[model samples]
Target: MRENLAPVSSQNMAFTDCTKPTDLSTEKKRKNWRNRIGFLLKTNSSESTLHIMKNRSCRPTADDVNQWAQSLDTLLSHKYGKAAFCVFLKSEFCEENIEFWTACEDFRTHTSHKELVSKANSMYEEFIKSEAPKEINLDFHTKNAIVQSLHEPTATSFQSAQRKVYSLMENNSYPRFIHSDLYKELCDAARREGKHIKS
Candidate 1:
């Protein structure tokens, strides 16, 4: 007895192996695999690899600092925001001002806060003398002293001096001119204030 076998046609074979439209999940999976392979091939290319290496090696430049300064200024103008004047002052004017330098030092030496205040006071006086005609107002001087003091209210003499200056400035009765060509008068005042507070 012989058994008859049907021949497989090209169309039948193709239909048997071909995926159906209903099998969308498998098609999606295949597409994802192709995409991953393409990405890998692109990253392995010489140009792409070089670009990645170059980006990693780049360093910050002066332009970066300028941009950062501009950003800081913008942030500072916002109300109740995380703005800092100290940062601006340090970045912009600290290098040019001696008083700022002394204040920074005073900040680090908590024990010598009074001395620092005193030193700042003196420096302001000197600054006024050197930059004469643009006299240092009593309020400015008092503020400098207070900043240097770091919130420390020292001896009676120091307190008295600060009070006197404050009173004069507040009353707007302080003398506008200095006599006897007193050089380093501001420095002297700062030094005396520091000494009195420290003692």
Candidate 2:
């Protein structure tokens, strides 16, 4: 008989190296960077066009964002309006208002009928539905209008509802966001870092 083979035990086989545990802070930073890149890609073309418009400038300084915070009208009227509002809202725990508003904005940009229908349905399900995770506060009339519009999706189908939510945030949430300690901290941090107002 030939020599016998050895048993496949740890002593016989080579051991594989173990990977080090991941740093949660590093992972979080990586995720944040990825999200930032994704947002930039989504708004790249639109932002480029707006960049050329002096009044709608996309590159805002810290002071500009601070100034925008002084009035809800000024903040929402900016080309990158959601940029600052979203950051502020996140801190105040009222981010759904801006998220729904921005989703409506993106919904209106779809040119294809199929895409319009798809996005409209998702938007309605997510924000207009009574118990949706991100359900928006809407009046009965506005909610009914969205229900009727779902049959034939159009660019402006969500306009009325969007306007209502915009008004709600502007009147109710904006004042608190502007004066919150988070706002002051953001401005202070920006001043120290010498970075543009990105949120």
Candidate 3:
């Protein structure tokens, strides 16, 4: 008769390395990183969504720093909606201006009519201070040069003018920056000289 071989007991089965705690922890960290990256990508793609990464108070590894910076670049490249812009502004200028920061955040979180009006007023003031001056120049020759270069009747200039016209049409009913006093005066002077300004 052949020698009988005993069956292996359950306790004698081989131990698997997959069940180790360290391995599980590593897998969990990888999954968390992947999920964070996916969230950043989705937020960057959508204008309505805002991506506020966790504050960098804690010291992060080199890899984490690189990832955060890359995500920020992606977010900036995307077209940010009003809500997202408010959040981004809050994050960017909060330390500089607490009142403005609070107003923006409040507007983003609460859609109250009164709060919106307050936020709009603040934004208007900020816009006037930042953008109004840049739109107008003290030197008339510089302004004329810019206009002439931008409207040379070439394909490139025409395309650029088309974009400007579209932007003005969307923002203002009239294809002009009526808010700027300098622009208004320039138009008046041009009209006096019998020059027609085309959109």
Candidate 4:
């Protein structure tokens, strides 16, 4: 059985310890945030979505792309880098890390309690829950911390979980992304653009 199992990364944990959340005081709040986080805001006929970022089609310059190599923070801070990395992760089916991280980034901007609670519970269901649709690999302690925070649903509710996921991406996903063909294509495009600029 062990041989059949894939090697686990940092956040990907055995979820035999799944449990229910404690703080969602009302059933309404639970249902609202029960929505799954999606990678595509793809149109079939009618599709209204939020939190799912449209992949920025904008290109980055060679210098800008090169900056990403310096650190995970640099890559994430640059809009194109963020978009490109999101694409890369989507290819790997681990877009949840970036999705969760970005969701948390968006989470902090809300000042109203209603907005905070709403987004917090949604994120909890989408990523933190043991069987979440976009379930992210999280440890027991970190998972518990976020679960506890969700009861009150503050802007910082998912901060620790976000940081943990960020670390996982920085260590695991970012390195692979840097080497990925998708990134290489961006670099190639940047190089071509640089040559075009010179001539």
Best by lDDT: 4
The TM-score obtained by model 4 is: 0.70
Task: Pull out the clashing pairs in model 2.
Answer: none
Q: After superposition on all CA atoms, how large is the RMSD of candidate 4?
A: 12.9
Q: What is the lDDT of candidate 2?
A: 0.62
Locate the minimum summed-lDDT window of 10 residues in model 2.
1-10
Q: In model 4, where is the ten-residue run with the lowest total lDDT?
A: 33-42
lDDT of 4: 0.67
Q: Of models 2 and 4, which has the larger TM-score? A: 4
Greater-TM-score candidate between 1 and 2? 2
Please list the residue runs of candidate 4 whose C-alpha ends up more than 4 Å from where it truly belongs after superposition.
Answer: 1-58
Tens digits of per-residue lDDT, candidate 4, 38-146, equal 2221222333222212222444678888899889999999987887777666555578889988999999999988888888899888987666798787766777777
Residue range 1-199, candidate 1, lDDT tens digits? 1111111222132112112345446445444433433312224577855653465223222232223234433322332111122222222222222233233334345446566556545544443232333222233343345445544534321343334433332222111111111112322433443443357
Query: Which of the two candidates, 1 or 4, achieves a greater lDDT against the reference?
Result: 4
lDDT of 4 at 62: 83
| Every model's TM-score | 0.22, 0.62, 0.23, 0.70
Candidate 1, 10: how far from true, in Å?
99
How would you encode candidate 3's per-residue C-alpha lDDT over 1-199 as one tens digit per residue? 1111111211131121011244445345444433433322223343313232242222222333223233433322333212232232222222122233233334455355565455444433442122331121112332233245432222232233223323322333221222332223333433432321122
